[model samples]
Target chain A: MIHVVRKLFWDFEKEEQWLNEMSAKGMALTHYSWCKYVFTETPKNEYTYRIELLDNVPTHPESIAYIRFLEENGVECVSSYVRWIFLRKKSSEGAFDIYTDLESKIKHFKRINTLWNSVMWLEFIVGLANILIGVTNYFNSSSSISLVNVILGGLLILLGLVFLRAGAPIRKKIRKLQQENLIRE
Target chain B: MPESSERGALTEAVFYILLSLYTAMHGYAIMQNVKDLSHGRVDLGAGTLYGAINTLLEKNWIRAVEGEEGSRRKEYEITELGKTVIQGELIRLGELIANGKRIAGGESK
Candidate 1:
């Protein structure tokens, strides 16, 4: 059972659309709280979902539209205890469990991550090396030679910035997906 | 105009995507081709790969073709524009390799 808290910042249309699509595809769901919903059935029977949608702005049209979408699609089982979506296996005789090939994919993600990390570290080392060389040249050489130090310093700074710009997002995405996989297991 | 400028304009993933589409493949096929061609060096996530495919479709570099039902997915083919980009990339890479060889004093034969 995995629970994720999502603050409803945008119009609920997107969330509503996803829920409706999932429901149309056949998944049993129950709305436990104003902010909490649960899915009892999924491709993986071992999974459950709990989401907390915080209304950042109560009067926003997006928020109202989301509430409306939920209202239009959900059926009330009891006063507030309605099952928004319900999913059950069509037949109890067949295998309902999903066998995943995600492990190998995750391993490959780790390999990409390692390569990116090494590149970033190497970039940092190269920047530091250039900076050291720049400073050494600046102090021990003529004015004309010192101009080269200025160029090297600028190049190192640009290189460091570029490496950080490219590597950070890749690292974050890989880490989040890795966490998701770990949580699922 | 310069080799680095051209290479910098296109990423390794974008390069692979364009190269794979040259043979006219589907989303899943392109993903499989990237993995196979890179010898497992690149493995794009389904979400990311699909996102890239959609972007390429919007850019008009790849067009989707109807595929048969059951086990077959929709196919995509590279457009003339896509071919031009691939051609430019090849020339850029060639120039880079040639320049590098010269700098390393291996340009003699």
Candidate 2:
């Protein structure tokens, strides 16, 4: 039987862990889009799940080539949204790790950090613009505040703050890996 | 001296990649060859190999080979410049090993 789960994740690592946990309980992810995940019943620990951000969108030729390369290596691309890809390999096939070296791992985290940083800035700018619009509307009409605009603006800013908080641990991870690289690799 | 800027020590992944590409090989082949050559010491994950391949291509150290018609897997081979870089790296490694053996008093393997 198949099961559908609706959820959202800001942290890829946490999402991967949850997927693996589900797989360990005999639920293997069959598809994913936006915030919805489709799973099918399977033997316990049938597959290991990994989530990665590609350098390009899934439809891009470069991303296609990359996905094909991974497929050749016994890893399967199950689903993708934007530049983020969901990958899996059979548990009996041994460990599945995308970034094996310090440099690559650092680069991966930096990519994630860059994404969060950019989204945060975008949300902050849009939120501020919405607030300015609300203020202007209120002043011109000399009436009650534009409650909808203000509320929407506040929510956006709050979301931006959440993004900022999410980015801190990624930055810390990058720094830790870089420090290790200096002394070891 | 211009070439000297590019002559710095290659990362273990890059070094093994160039070595494996001396003969034409695809991404999966390169990964397998690296592991075998390193006696299973170095395992090239797919993502790492992809990034390294692109960087090597950008540097003109490796070129993609035309694969058989209808084949989706692309192959790559090391260029002359890549061969020269590895030659220099071999010499550098030789020096390091020789000095370590001479001073540290370990018998040369």
Candidate 3:
């Protein structure tokens, strides 16, 4: 079964939960395209999944090397898209989770926060630009279709606001990790 | 002096990594060494090991060596600087153990 989810800035926890839910339903993710995840039927909860943000997957030599290493260590490489790799290993009592210690967990959260922040920055700038351009055209146009510009401007501004609002929760999680880590050190 | 100051304290991962890489060892080998040395108490996940390797490389505490291409067989060895850092870590650890022992039992005269 293939499910399409359009989440522009999907944070780590949400993505992990969705994947785990799908896995629990006996659908193993075999591939991903943009926002679509393609799954194949398997035994319910056959494997536990992990999603990692790494650059240059299935193409770059280093990424290939890393994947090969994991496969050798009993992890299966199910799919990859953009900077994300979806991995799963047979469900067991042994550690299937990628992060085992506090330091690594902290680093993983920091990486996730950095990636999302960069994407949100780009989205905000584009949204602002679209609204400005649309509003300018709306006021300057003498044509009957000038109302179209107003609608488009409003939509762009709303979309930008949505993105900005979505980013706050993830940033709060990252900040909490940062502060907690400092206290531990 | 600057390297020592910049490196600060070694995390267990970094400490065990340097210890394991006395000979050129790949990722799995290093993980195995750490787990074995710590009597199976310390285990390094693939992700954790990968992140630690990158950090060590960036700081020049470790350097990649020749390995068969396309294998997790990407081997690394500790640099001279890495050895010095390990030595410093051992001294610090010794001091810590000594202080703890004094509290646990009686102080050595």
- Interface RMSD over true interface Cα atoms for each candidate: 12.0, 1.0, 2.0
What fraction of correct interface contacts does each candidate retain?
0.00, 0.70, 0.61
Highest DockQ: which candidate? Answer: 2
Which stretches of model 2 miss by more than 4 angstroms? Answer: B1-5, B67-71, B105-109
Across A129-163, the per-residue lDDT of candidate 1 in tens digits comes to 76677677768764565566557656766766665
DockQ for candidate 2: 0.70
- Native contacts kept (model 3): 0.61
Q: Is the docking of candidate 1 incorrect, acceptable, medium or high quality?
A: incorrect
The DockQ values of the predictions, listed in order, are 0.02, 0.70, 0.54
What candidate 3 gets wrong by more than 4 Å, as runs, is A1-9, A56-62, A101-104, B1-7, B58-60, B65-72, B103-109
Q: What is the TM-score of chain A alone in each candidate?
A: 0.39, 0.95, 0.77
Q: What is the TM-score of chain B alone in each candidate?
A: 0.77, 0.89, 0.85
Stretches of candidate 1 exceeding 4 Å from the true structure: A1-185, B1-8, B69-72, B104-109
Global CA lDDT of candidate 1, please?
0.52
Which of candidates 1 and 3 reaches a greater TM-score?
Answer: 3
Worst 10 residues of 1 chain A by lDDT: A74-83
